[model samples]
Target chain A: MKRFLLISLIWPGYLLAQDNARQIEMTQLLLIKNHQVLSGNKQPDGLAEHSETVLRKAERYRYQGDFDKAVPLYQQAAQLNPKRQGYIGYVHLAFLHDYSRAMQYLNAYDALTPTFDDIEGNNPVSYYRGVIYLKTNEFALAIEQLNKSIGDIERKHGSEWVNYRYYVSRARAFLATSQPQKALDDLDKAVANYKKSALAYYHRGLALVQLGRTAEAKSAFQDAQFFFGAKRVEALQAGQAVIPEDQLFPLYESEIEAAIDQLKLKP
Target chain B: MKKQGWRNGKKYALPGLFLFGFWLTTTAQPLTRDQLTGQWIGVHAELNNASLCPLSTYLDLRSDGSFYLGMVDGKAPPKVMTWAMKAGQLRLDVLTYALDLISLTNDVLRIGQDSPMLFRRFQEIAVDSTAAFQTLNGRVWETDSLRLSLFANGKLLWENCQTYEQTVHCWQLARYGTAVFLVTRGNAHTCEGDYKPLWQLTQSGKQQFRAIGWNGQAVATETFRLVRPLKLSEMPPANEFQRCANCFDGSRYSVAEPFLRRYQPMLYDIRKAFEQYYKPVVASGQSGLVQIQFAVDCDGRMGRFLVKGFDNDYQAKSFDPQLVAQLLTICRQKLPAGWRRDPLTDQQQSDIDVLLNVRLSNGTITDVFL
Candidate 1:
C-alpha cells in the first residue's frame, strides 16, 4: 500500500498535488456530513441522472460476466459519487465468492465510507470469508459461516437463501468428504428446497458405490443424466452455468467424484 | 422457514446481484452441478478413531449415535450387539450357549462392593489331538520379521528379543491363543544364542509378552492379535523385504525353524533360519552315518554348518544361512506391529534360549539331537 501511495505521488501528468489534497479533503467532508450534502440536496439534477445511467450500464456489463468492462465504469461512478453503496457492493460481491479476494473489497468499503450501507456492511471480513466457506468442501465450516450470515440477513431481509445455500452446500460437503450415509441424510433434506435436484441422486449413488451396489450406481448416473438434460439446460444457456455432467465426470470418476468436481467449480 | 438462512444472505447480496438479474433471465440455464447433486456417490463413513489403528473391525454407529461392531471376523452379518462404545467407554456383552466345558464363574469381584471384576477365559487340554494344517509342514518360507517366546519346560523365560537376522538357536513353534509361542529351548554351550524376551507389557494387570519366540533361538516378543485378512482384492500389493521402511533402520529380520529332536534331553533342534532361498542339504549319497553340528544364535540366524559324510568331491553346496538371516531380519522388522516396547531398561536386554543342533544323517536327516 505504501508502494502504491509512493507511485501515486511520483506519477507524472496525474492528478495535481493540490487536486489530490482537494479530493481527500472532499471525501472527508462528505463522510462527516453523513451524505446529507451529497444526497437529498445540492447535486445538480443532470449529475444524478448521469450517475444513474452509468450505474445501470456498469451493472449490465457485470450481468454479462464482463467484469473487466464493469470494473472501470463502477470505479467512475464510485469516484463521482462515493456515497452510493451499490457501487462498492458490486466489487464486494465479486470478491465474496473467493474468500481471499472478498477481503480486498471489504477493506476498500470500510475505508471509503463513514456509515456502511447494509447492517452487515460493518461486519469483519472474516464473516464474508465464512460466507465463502459455505461453498467449500468443508461443510462444518460452511454451516458456521452461513450461521453468521443468518442473523444479519434476518435483520435485513428474511432467511431462505442463506439457509438453503447452507443446507445444500453442507449436504454437498458431507457427500464429498464425510461418510456417504451422513451425506445421504443431509441431501434428503436439501432436495426439498427446489425438489428435482440431481445432487441428492448423485450423493445416493456415491453411497451405493461405497455400499458396493454397482447396479444402483448405474441407475444414479442415468438419473443424473436425466436431470442435467432437463432441469439444468436453462442454467447453461444463461451462462450462470450449471456444470454439465461430462465436465464434472470427465473420466471414470465414480458418481461421488463427479458431484464434488461439479460443486467445486468457480462461478 | 423455507430456504431460510441462504435467503437472508442472498438478500444482503441482492443489491450486488441487481446487476446480474438481467443475466439470470438471459442465460435461463440452471446450474448443472446443483442438478446432478443427487447423482453423486456417497463418501464412505470413516470413524474418527479406528481410522489410524490397525484394528480390523469398525464401530458401526446408528443415526442416534448408538454403536455396533462392523466388519467382525470377516463375516457379512456382523456379530450383532456384541459390544458398544457409549460415551467414550466400552461395554462388552455376549450371548451365551449352554455347552459345558469345565465350569467357572464368569466375573470375579475384587472383594469390595464397588469393585466388580470381569474375567473371560478359554482353555484347551490336549489328548494327542493333532493334525498338520499349515502349508509349510517341512518347507520354509521367508518373512521380514518374527516375534517369539522361549520356554525351557512349560514356564516362559523373561529374556526375549527379536532380531532382524538369525543368531544361533531355532525351535519348532506351538500355537498359543491368537499368538504362536515357543515350546522348546536350545543349548547354552554354543555361541551366546538364546531365546530372549524383548518387549513386555501388562495386560489384565499381569506381565505379558509383546513379541516372543516361536522356535529355538527364535526371539520374537510381539502380541499377534487374531485378525481376519482383508479380502485379497482389497489388500495392497505385497512389498519386498528391501522396500520395507524399517529394513534400513539398522536391525535385520530373520525367522527360525524349530524341529522335534528324537534323541536328546532338549525338545527341539532349532535351525538358524528358513530355507527360502536355497534348500537345506541333509546329505544325499554314500554315507554310513553323517554327523552335522550347527549352532543357533540370539538373532534367530543359523550359522557354522558342519555336515559330515559326503564321500565324493562335494557339489557347489552353500549353506543358505544368509538368505535365512535376511528372512529373519525381515520378520524382526515387521513382527513388532502390535508390540508394546518395554519402557524399562530402555529396551537393551532380552531373555532367550539358543539351541545347538548335533545331527547324524545317513540319507534322510539322522537322529537330530539338540
Candidate 2:
C-alpha cells in the first residue's frame, strides 16, 4: 500500500516536469524560428550580431549563386532590420522574379523610407520601381517612373549621367505599346551613348523590323551578333559580365537569320 | 489491500494508454549516418496551402557528414551545412530546424511530427568528366515530348513536340569542384519573362544523361547517339548579314534629304500647320515624337503621306489612324509647292522614301529633322 501510494505521488510530479520541459522546448523552437539564439548571452546586441552574421552568410551564398539559401537568410535579416527591405525587394525582383513578394518588400521599404523627391538626391528606388513596372507589363507606369529616374539623374549629375539602361528600358516600354518609331529613336540614343551594349543593338534590330526597315534591321542584328560574340568570349576569359546562360539572349543567330529570311520573302 | 491496489491501477489505465500512444508517435526509430549518405529528393510539403506551389527539395548527405540542401531545378544554389541525427530527431546546425524522424526504409526517408514529408534516393550513374562534354557536343538528344540539340558555338535548340514550339537558347558549361553545371537561358515561361535553369549534368549510362531540375528532382532522361560530328568550319557564322536586293538603302536616298533642306525656308509655316492640326489632340504636359512619311514623286507632287505618333495607343485614344491621316493632310498642304525631278540613278528610280521627324513638346513644335 505504501509502495502504491509513493508511485502515485511521484507520477504526478513526473507528469508536471514533462509538461514544463515540453513548454521550454516549444519556446526554444519558436525562438530559433525567429532567428534568436537560446543562449545565456542573449541580448539586444547579441541579436544584432546574429543578424549581421546571417546577413554576411546570406551575401556569401548570393555571391556563390546559392539564392535558395540566400533568400531565407535575407528574410531573417529583413526581420532583424526593417531597413533591409529594399535590398530584399531588389533580390526578389531581380533574382527570384517573384513579383508579388518583391512588391510586398518594396511596399515595406516605401513605408519605412521617405518619398523620392524628399530625399534631396538621386536614388535607385525609382529605377527599380520602373524595372518592376516594366516586368509587370505596366508600360505607361514604367515610362513615367523611368522618365522620373532619368530626370532626377540629369538634374543632379548631368545629361551625361543618363545611362543607356534607362533609354533601353523606355524603348522596351515603347515597343510594348506598339510605338515602334519611338522605340527606334530611344534605341538609337542607347546605341549612340553606349556602343558596347549588344542589348541595345538587338532591340534596335527589333524596332527596325517593326518599322519595315529590313536592311537596317539586318545591319543591327549583325552588330548585335558581333558584340554578343565578343562579350561571350570576354566573359569566358575574364569571368566578368557573365549573365546566367539561359538569360544571355532570348534570340540567337539562327532566329535572327530566320527573321531576315522571312523579311526577304515578304516582297 | 491487493484488491484495492488493483482498483487504483485500473483507475490509471486510460492515462497510461494515452502516454504510451504519445511516446509511440513522437519517438521514431533511429537512423544510422551511413544510411543517410547520398542524394535524396523530396517535395516541400510545408507549402501545402493552395496559394503556395510546392517545389522539389534535395538533400545531398555526403559520407563525410556534411550536407547540401537545395532545389534540384538549378534555380538557386544549394545551402551547405552540417547535419546530425540524435534521439530520433534530425538537426541542421545552420538552419537550427529539427524534425522528428517518422520512418526511413528502402531509400525513402520520412520526417516530421504531424504531416511527414517523404524523400527518395536517386540511382546515380558514374560519369566520366573529361569526355562528357565532348560526347554531348553536336548530338541530338530526344525523349517522348522533347528534342534538344547542343551546338559547339554555345547555342542550344530546344523543341517541344507537344507544343510544337521551338526556342533557341544559349548554353554554357561551368564547373564547381566535381559538380558540372550546364547553364541554359531563356526557357522559363513565367511572368518575369526569361529564367535561367542551371542543370547539373550527370551521365546515367552509355550515351545517356539525366537533367536534374531546379527543385532537385529528375526532370529529363535524355539519350544521345552521335549521327554527325559538328565541324567549326561547317557551322554557320553568327554574323552573316542578309540584305534584300530591293530594300531601301538610306545612303542612296540623297534626293529626299536635299529636298527637305531646300524646304527649310518654309519651316515656320510647316511647324505652324503641324501644331494647329495636332495641338488639341496631343495631351497637355506630354511630349511626343511624330514621324511623317511622304513621297516626293518624279512629277514633284506631295502624295502618299502617312503620320505616325510616338504616344502609345492606350495612353491617348485621339492619336489614331484618323488623326494620323488628318496630320498627314496638314503636312501635305503645308509643303512647298514645286519640286524638280533629280537625275535618276538606276538604283534610285522609285518614289523617294522621305521620313521626317517632328518633335512636339506640350502641344508646340520643338524641332524637325530628317
Candidate 3:
C-alpha cells in the first residue's frame, strides 16, 4: 500500500516533467501542424442542458446570423426561464432591430413586474420602449415612454443620478417635434451629466440651429467635432471591437462638420 | 533596547518578507516558452458577460519563434509573425500583452482582458488529403438541411435547402497527419465568418460519405448522400460571386466601420425609397423583420446580397415575394448614383459591408434599422 501511494504521488510529477520535455523537443522539430480541426463529440440533448446553456447556444447562432437555428432555441430558452424574456427583448431591440416584436417581448417582460418599472439587460423596460417608439418614428409615444423612465428617476434621485443618454434620447424626441426650447433644456442636462459627450454636443448644436442661435450652434458644433475626435482616439486605443460613443448614438463626424459649414455660411 | 528591537523587527521581518516576495513572484511567474509553442484551435470569444460566439480561427506557434494565425476554414493564407517573451510580457506579432493577460491550464490558453479569447490545444491526426480528394471531387452531395456541390476546379457551392440561401466558396482537402479536413473559404461578406466549420472526413463509400463537423452548437457527424456527378458544362460564375477587392482581415473592416458615416444621407434616401416602392401585400399573420446584408466593394459597387426573415415571434420564416423583391430592388439598383464612389477616396479606404433590417407589419414597412 505504501509503494502504491508513493508511485501515485511520484507518477504525476514524472508525467508532467515528461510532458514539458516532449513540448521542448516538439518545438525543435518545428513541423508546421495544422491546428484547424473540428474538435468535439456529438451535441448533447437540449433538454439535458440548463436554460442558460440554451440561451448561450441561441446567442452563438444569432451572432452568426443563422436565425433558422437561433429562433427555436431562443423560444426554448424563454419557455425554460421567464426572466430571459427581457434579454430576448433587448436582443430584438438592439441586435435584430425588430421594434414591434421587441415591444411585445418588453411588454411581456414588464407584465411580470406590474407595480414598478422592470429592468431588462442594463436598461429599464420604459427605456427600451422609448427607444422602440423613437425607432418606429412615434415621437409622441417616445416622449411619453421616456417621461415614465426619466421622470421617476429624476423625482427620486434628482437629475444627476439619471443617465445622460436618457436625456439625449428625450431631447431627440423633442427636436423631432420642433420643441427646441425643451430640447435645449434636455441638452443642457445631458451636457452637465456627461461633459465630454460628443452626442450631447452634436444634438445641442442641432437645437441651437433650430432656435436660430447661429453663433452658439457653430461653437457647439466645434465642441462636438473636438470631442468626436477625442472619442475616436480613445476607441482606437481600446483596440478592435470597442464600439465608439458616436456609434452608440448613431451620430457622425460628417454631420457635425456639415452643421458647422452650414452655420459658417449663415454668418 | 536596540538588541530587542532588532530581534523583534529587523532580523526575522527582513528574511520573512523576502521569502514572501519570492513566493509571490514565483507563483505568478510568466508562462515558459515550451508551454506556449504549440498548435491551438480557437474555442470562442466571451462577448459581454458570458455571451460567447464561436471563434473559427487557429494559431500555430513554432519553435523558430514564428507564429501563424488564420481562419480555420479560410483560403486566405495564414499570417506569419515572430513572437517572444520579453520582460514578462507576451508578444503576439506587434500586440504586447501583459503576463497576467494570458493564462494556460490543462491544454487551454486564454488571452486578453474583458473579452478573453480561448484556445484549446490541437492534436493532429494524420490523414491523406489525396485520398479525401478522390472521394469528394466533382460530386454533388445532399443532406437534410444542406446541399453541397464540389467541383473539380477548386470551387464548391453550399445551399441551405431549407432557407434557400446559396453561397459559393473555394474548397480544399487539407491533410494534418492522418486526419483530412474539408476546408471551405467564403468571400468578404460571407455570414458564416470568413469560412464555415472545418469538416473532418471520417467514413467514405461509393454512395454515402460522412464527416464530423460543427452543427450549429456542437460537433456532429453529417452523412452526405451522393446526389449526382458535377457536369463540365457548369461554370463557376465569377461575376455573380461578389468579393471585396481588399478585405484582408474579415471582421476588421466591417466591425470598425459598421456603417460609413458618409453614407448617412444615402442611407436615409434608401429608407425613404423602400417605403415608397413598398406595395403592401396585406397578408394576415405575416408580420416580421426582413434583414438584408450586402457588401459594397472598394470600387463602390454593391453586390452579394443575402436576405433573412423572422416572424413576429422572431422565428425564422419566409415573407411575401413582393415585399422581399421590392426591398431587394431598392438596395441593389435604386441607391442614389453618388453611392457608387467612396466619398473619402483621398484616404484610400477599403470596401464597406452594410446590414439593413426592416420591420414589416403584414406587407407595409414600419421601421428601417440602419
Largest DockQ belongs to which candidate?
3
Please give the ranking of all candidate structures by lDDT, highest first, separated by commas.
3, 2, 1
- Tens digit of per-residue lDDT, candidate 3, span A106-177: 888899989979997567899888888888789999999999999999999999988888899999999999
Q: Is the docking of candidate 3 incorrect, acceptable, medium or high quality?
A: incorrect
Best by TM-score: 3
Q: What is the lDDT of residue B176 in candidate 3?
A: 50
Winner of 1 and 2 under lDDT = 2
Candidate 2 C-alpha lDDT tens digits along A197-242:
7778878988988888889888887887788677656765674433
RMSD of 1: 38.2
Please give the distance, in angstroms, between residue B69's alpha carbon in candidate 3 and its true position after superposition. 16
Residues A1-267 of candidate 1 have per-residue lDDT tens digits of 453334323221111121212322221221122211122233547755666667666755443323445556766666666545433553434321222333444445556654543333444333444444543345577556545554556567754433333344444555556556665555555555545655556656666566566676657656655664565456545643233222111212233445545434523
- Which should have the higher TM-score, number 1 or number 2? 2
Once fitted onto the true fold, the runs of candidate 3 whose alpha carbons sit more than 4 angstroms away are A1-49, A111-114, A237-249, A257-267, B1-287, B294-304, B309-323, B333-355, B361-364
| Local distance difference test, each candidate | 0.33, 0.55, 0.68
TM for every model, in the order presented, reads 0.24, 0.34, 0.52
Question: Tens digit of lDDT per residue, candidate 2, span B10-86?
Answer: 99999999999999888764666667778875432221111111223467878776887664444455667777766
Error of 2 at B363 (Å): 48
Ordered by DockQ, highest first, the candidates read: 3, 2, 1
- What's the TM-score of chain B for every model shown? 0.18, 0.37, 0.55
